[model samples]
Target: MNVKMNGFISLVLGIGLLHTASAATHSLKYFYTAVSGDIDYPEFTAVGLVDNGQFMYFDSSTKTAVPKTEWMKREGADYWDSQTQGLIGEHQTFKVNIQTLKDRFNQSKSTGVHVVQRMYGCEWDDDSGATEGFDQYGYDGEDFIAFDLKTTKWIAPAPQAVITKLKWDSNTANNEHRKNYYTQECIDWLKKYMDYGKSTLMRTVRPSVSLFQKTSSSPVTCHATGFYPSDVMVSWQKDGQDHHEDVEYGETLPNDDGTFQKSIHLTMTPEDRKNNKYQCVVQVKGIKDDFIRVLPDQDATNVVPIIGGVVALLLVVVAVVVCVVIWKKRSKKGFVPTSTSDTDSDNSGRAAPQI
Candidate 1:
């Protein structure tokens, strides 16, 4: 009985270990670098690992996951080990199919994190040696060749989102670190444009005063700007009746880039200005039934108080002038000498003459 029980326990332990290994076989962590010339030597160091089918390679500056396909296609494989050298020696060729590396990464099942790849010591040389003329070196030589990902025969599961295209521009002075940083920035800008395009289209209207004239000789013009195409209507109405005869409406002037703008001029007489019932109606294309009132010009209304003040001032001045004339006439008459005093003096003189 003791022997049988020990055997059963050993069998259980073996099965458990096998299960753990199988689970770990489908995951991997790999490092990739973006180089200018060749896969053997890189110009920039972007070292990270991915495991469990998730991109753990977070860019420190952008705080976002690096695009896997971009790094894979542009930089190629950064993993080089003794086994790879041996395979190249046996085959008498340094070329390895890119699909082979991709398959190896997809099938790895290591549970813990592993540093499967590292890229460093990136340099370039354009000057030729004594025997060669202008030999460009570093990552950009024929020393190493990789299979193009698109032309490869192997196929894997489809990605969640297929990136159709990618484009980038970088300064010549950009090094490995700066290239990675700028790549993240470029990706962010593209995403924002995509989001803007996908959002719903919205319509808006802004009213502006084009011309304001209180005089009847000139017309008061009101314009509505910033209206979208297929959403604009402008007209003039006086006393709730369309006044097309007296109003001159200009054709909608299109912006140089094909945007819509409109202006309406309504000439008013003195009688029309006093009535206070003229309005410029703006109806958006979608909101035809809705009534949107642009602010009416109050210059005509404001003139009433000013005119009343001038009339009152004129009346006060006229009254003051009439009172001053009356006072002057009365003063002249009252200051004149009386003839009675002169007669008494004459009578005294006559009595002296008679004596």
Candidate 2:
């Protein structure tokens, strides 16, 4: 499958779902990133998401896997311990992969930074119980390689990764194993995870949608926040026609309270607004009603930026706090190696912290 995570560095992949919408879907994903320098951050870090909702996290510093939600804590220590071990294996592998990538990219002599990242996951269609799996890798914020199940092939998107792809594709047994892992094992784990956090994961929350301008010169942004499952669509219309010009879509992000938020900007001038009717429409996957805000509404101005900025700021603070806590708790006695950093990313889009 073609993975869609694009804004990984800032950690807003802008998107996935949960609560098994009758026609909606949920996803179970894992993101891992390795950096190649001694930065005051995790050398290796991984996160697990169910329907784009993060449930667990692990990093080289803490050397432990921990649950992020109360419902996730239902799993015993053994489960967390097993996850820790699994991430530990991944950490070592990524450490080596970073170096190998450095060599492959001929960046060994470079003084700057380098990174390798992996994001793999499965999406489950709740209505029909259909599942799709994808696996991809990136280097220095660009696409590198991905696995295709139908052909059981490892495809390299970049020429630099061709040699590695050829080597991986040549290994029939390993390819078969990967195929089974994505199709069967990954789905099995995903189902179990949904069950494990059903109370929280099974609920749906509608978004509070708004339309406002940051400044008179700024675009009119359709903002949606405080929704669950993260899968949402915000669009614009002019004179009852679909409007797409100069529209900017933003990354879907998580709030401090575990809800999700997103904003899309529609650029227009005050003069243009007077001649055409403009409306902001929001459609959440499971919620049946459409939330709409027409232009010239008495209350629809000068609110989005303040709200959006506050949400974005709060998210950054939470992320920083979590990262800092993990770093502080990390064991100082472990072997330190050169590696790159990873940003906690999104579902449809593959993203990581820029190296």
Candidate 1 TM-score, true structure as reference: 0.26
lDDT of 1: 0.29
Predicted structure with the largest TM-score when compared to the true one: 2
Ten-residue segment with the worst summed lDDT in candidate 1? 346-355
Residue 278, model 1: lDDT of 74
lDDT of 1 by residue, 1-355 (tens): 0112111111111111111112111112122222211222222222221111111232223322333322222222332222232222312211222222223345233232111111111111113211100100111111111111122211111221011011001212222222332233323322332233222122334433244443446566656554543235678777777768677764343232223345677776666666567777776553445444443445534421223433353344333220000011111112221101112110110000000
Candidate 1's C-alpha runs over 4 A off are 1-211, 214-216, 255-259, 288-355
The alpha-carbon lDDT assigned to residue 237 of candidate 1 equals 73
Over 197-247, each residue of candidate 2 has an lDDT whose tens digit, in order, gives: 887887778888877665667777777888876777788999999999999
Best by lDDT: 2
Stretches > 4 Å off in candidate 2: 1-8, 12-22, 297-355
Q: What's the CA error at residue 103 for candidate 2, in Å?
A: 1.3
TM-score of 2: 0.81
